[model samples]
Target: MKVNKDLTATASANLILDELYTNTGSSSFNLEHDFFYGGAELEIWTMANQAGILLTEDTDYTLSDIDDTLTNQASRNVYKAVTIDNVTYQSDDIYFSYQACADFVDADDRYMVTREDGQYWDLNSSGGFDLVVSDDITFKDQYLASAIPLSESGTTGLEGF
Candidate 1:
């Protein structure tokens, strides 16, 4: 999936990484910290007043419900489809950044979608199997040093390690 850099709408730039890496660069030259700050925030809302409507009467619900809510809120415009292994999957949970919802309207295919940072996987599919999202989805976060230790040599650069 591509994270769009266009702040005009909600879709922000999405990048894929085969492995995770830690930033050991200087505080002013840290690429990871800059990368995380570049990420956009997504906001989701209901189209109809039935925003509280639950997909299922039972406590248990399928991913379909989430997919439906998104698509329905988006009205199928911004995020028309989600494909996995060339197979398109539909969901009610559609996501777009905060800016994307500015002019958003709710219609048949209109629904709200939110961007989340972390791993998301589709535990089940119509093919009678679960599809791991690890291979298909990419997550981004604001990179920052977990902790910045103080420097003894008066080198402030080593303090925020």
Candidate 2:
């Protein structure tokens, strides 16, 4: 009879190695935290509110849930986009930056994004939107380096001395 054993420890180590070297092809143990920063692609629906354009939960632009924040180490820097008459335009894209929130706790769930002209808008039930956000984000890892690598020289055999 054969018994199966879990390789949790080995798997954990491999997971760490893959993440560190997935982009650079080499692991860097010197990172203060195991937060590997990477770029992620995202698409959010938008709508024109009373003030200006804002993100909507669904393509209908009638949803109340507004996903205004990209929860990362830093604020999610987003590049905006819009669709009109079944045609997309990139030049008319909007840029929204993270600003102060009424409550930091609420900010964790969803925060406000201000326009480049320093204006914050409210969401309204208007046309549907197609907003694309591509930004770099860093995530934290639980593991830490416990040991350093040691060097060893090859052994030469001298028999019958």
Candidate 3:
């Protein structure tokens, strides 16, 4: 299955999840497809962007749900400003580079569980990856909205997607 990263992160993530579920018989764990694409991936993008890190196609990082992790060892530059719960924390404080931090946030399994209404948190404290909340689920909504114009009424009109 091919996925376009340019599309909102959730759609892209769903494509990945679909491919994985088809090939590996994996379950989405009650999380929406948008959780991976928009929530996890976008968190990486936002954190990287906030650190003044530009994710170039080759120089940046890539996300994989097969093993479920985000990695960018290209430059290994550490970040200093990372805000969590409105409190800023430094990557140096945790001795993790910005990319590593993003990877941890995106890939860690504990963060995937539903904690409350619209909230998912890290239940593991072993690695100290810091607590993060999932955000930006609109990508899936936008994809669904985009489908309205193409849907025919009966046959699955999810052709171009």
Question: Largest lDDT belongs to which candidate?
Answer: 3
lDDT of 1 by residue, 1-161 (tens): 21323323333333222211122121122111111111132222122222433222112211111234333454432332212111111223322222222212212211121114443322122311133222222322113112222455432121111
Query: Compared to the true structure, candidate 2 yields what TM-score?
Result: 0.17
**Each prediction's Cα lDDT score?**
0.24, 0.22, 0.26
Better of 1 and 3 by lDDT: 3
* lDDT of model 1 at position 77: 26
Q: Which predicted model would earn the best TM-score?
A: 3
Clashes of 2: 0
RMSD of each: 19.8, 23.2, 17.7
**lDDT for each residue of candidate 3 in 47-149, tens digit (9 for 90 to 100):** 3223433233222222333222221321222221222221122121211111112322243233343433655443222333134333222122232212222
Stretches of candidate 3 off by over 4 Å are 1-72, 82-103, 107-111, 116-118, 123-126, 129-161
